[model samples]
Target: MKIILISLITLVSLVSCSNNSQVVSPKLDPLNQQFISEDELFRLVLHMDKLDYRSDEKIQLHSTLEYIGTEKKATIWHGMPYINYLITDGKDFSVGGVVSTILKSTTLEKGEVYTFPYIKTGAFSENDPNADFWREFFDEKDLYLPPGRYTLTVYCGFSLTEDVVNSKYNNKVEVEITVD
Candidate 1:
């Protein structure tokens, strides 16, 4: 009985030591806006550089599209890449234009990461029919964000669909951002 007890104590100590040394990654936000398609072929991860921002400051964000399936997948997008943002209170800041060509597709292999250029968030507007404020050229006009909390949604895709102005993205990631 004495020998058995000593062995048990030694095993428990080893287990405890291993558990203490185990590495754990930080948990992502519940609303960080990660989505996997119904088929599980692709995963979309969307997040902003920071959770809070000063008024009129440029809010930077990134969208990463990863192919998770065993086989390579190709998807079509017609025009330049853009993110669709819809705030919680029913305000939106989005833009889309005509695609000169037809059927632009991007192919990705398993475990591949497709990186997009850092995109800056736009000001919220309900009456800007043109949605021109989302454009980078109009930086002078982008200083219109008010002090409040807003939901920053990012839909990853080419902005060249009939529902570009109205339809939300099938694969989207979102994050809650604040303006102070």
Candidate 2:
């Protein structure tokens, strides 16, 4: 009887431990403006005002990083622009901005959130081969996306510490949009 009781307690403990280690899926906002990706230490959310737009409309994009680990605080080391955006038509058209090479760090406590916005400067040179195509798609005066479907991916490139790891993390979330 004593042996049976000990076995049952051990089995119950094992089951509870396994349950605690199970992966949890990221939750989404009801309105769909926020798309989420997560890991054991953090949660990244990509935010777009809407999923549909006109050919001449200006799209606003940003991302947020939230510390979700059990630790009191976590430090992330990355480039000047920790988070960046990549917009692609999945064919011939793609647009992304250059990021500064300067290193930076940010620390966050559990449940704290940090925001990063998409920013671009300068325009394509007129002498470039794709100058005409780029002019039609965007200009220095205003930014617009041509009429088509696009996949916008927001990625946060960082490492847990300043020390070089075997591989750094580029956590990203992709969402599709349409322009009439």
Candidate 3:
């Protein structure tokens, strides 16, 4: 009787363990940030709430633009200042996402800083133009990034003149993150 009871208990435990199946997202490694540019006309600072994340987790990124000039400067530009991210895996690069910022033309006072709200990486349009015609081809799933080491370089704004962007004032911040 003792032997039979032990066999039955072991079988029950095995069946119960096998029934416990749950879907869990992959875990990510810690994030790393690198600042490349030193031009002080406008400074871009990046902040992430947590360094590590899972594939299903939302990567919350906050960026701020501070006017570091001594006096007020006329910041003239075309459209609203937008964000572009270049993500790479040491081999190839992917246009991670783009935030289509819609802001009216404005000037920045000395020492004034503009902080943008946290932009969730999971819910961004992957460089989509957001036109009414091409809406059908884009979806949130298309932007799903797998677990890997990614270096994300963010360009804050485009230069007023194409030549200046190539030669001077290309404000940007680069950060490295691991998504597992």
Candidate 4:
């Protein structure tokens, strides 16, 4: 009887230990997705909140630059808007803008990440030339585009050091999304 009790205790202890040793993985966010591009010195990741959106719903877009080089730290010099976007639907209709000529600089350590400013979407005025045509499909505030598939291309332009006149790097990544 003593032997039987000892065996039962050992089995229970083993089961409890096994349960405690199990590792639970983290759940991924469905709304947030990433498209990535990498080079010898940097890894650029483009983040989109969702792949599909309603005609009235707004879209979210952003990007991150990670220092993947073997150096202790790296400096990036660029203009006011270091990141730019070009969105198109494989047709004549496209959306983009120009950035200011003001210069700026940013530093990052090894394995460190730098997040750029968020990309704004759907900010059109009723006085736009195509406002009347787009009004049939989208609301005034959501006049970026109609419901369809689009390819969003992000450009990360910078130089390694303060000498912007010399070498420059332009990292580009693209992500596809659908607007219902």
What would the per-residue lDDT of candidate 2 be over residues 27-139, giving only the tens digit for each residue? 43334488999999889988777999998788776677888998999887765456777788999668764444445666778986776666543245566687788766654
Candidate with top lDDT is 2
Candidate 1 at residue 42, lDDT?
A: 66
Which numbered prediction scores highest in TM-score against the true structure? 2
Report the poorest 10 consecutive residues by lDDT, candidate 3.
19-28
Give the TM-scores of the predictions, in the order they appear. 0.51, 0.71, 0.53, 0.65
Order by lDDT, highest first: 2, 4, 3, 1
Please provide, for model 3 over 34-58, each residue's C-alpha lDDT reduced to its tens digit, 9 standing for 90 to 100: 2434455777666555545687776
Worst 10-residue lDDT window, candidate 4 = 19-28
Candidate 2: list runs displaced more than 4 Å: 1-32, 121-125, 132-143, 165-167
Candidate 3's C-alpha runs over 4 A off are 1-38, 90-93, 96-105, 117-138, 141-144, 160-168
Give the Å shift of residue 17 in candidate 3: 56
Give per-residue CA lDDT, model 1, range 1-180, as digits (tens). 554456446544543454322111243333433433324666776655567778878655545666676666644343334334444533643322211232334445677666543423323233445545333434553323557777656565553235444542466666666788
Error of 4 at 126 (Å): 9.1
Separately for all candidates shown, the number of backbone clashes (residues 3 or more apart, or on different chains) is: 1, 0, 1, 0
Model 1: how far is 136 from its true place, Å?
10
How many clashes show up in model 3? 1
Clashing pairs in 1: 33-174
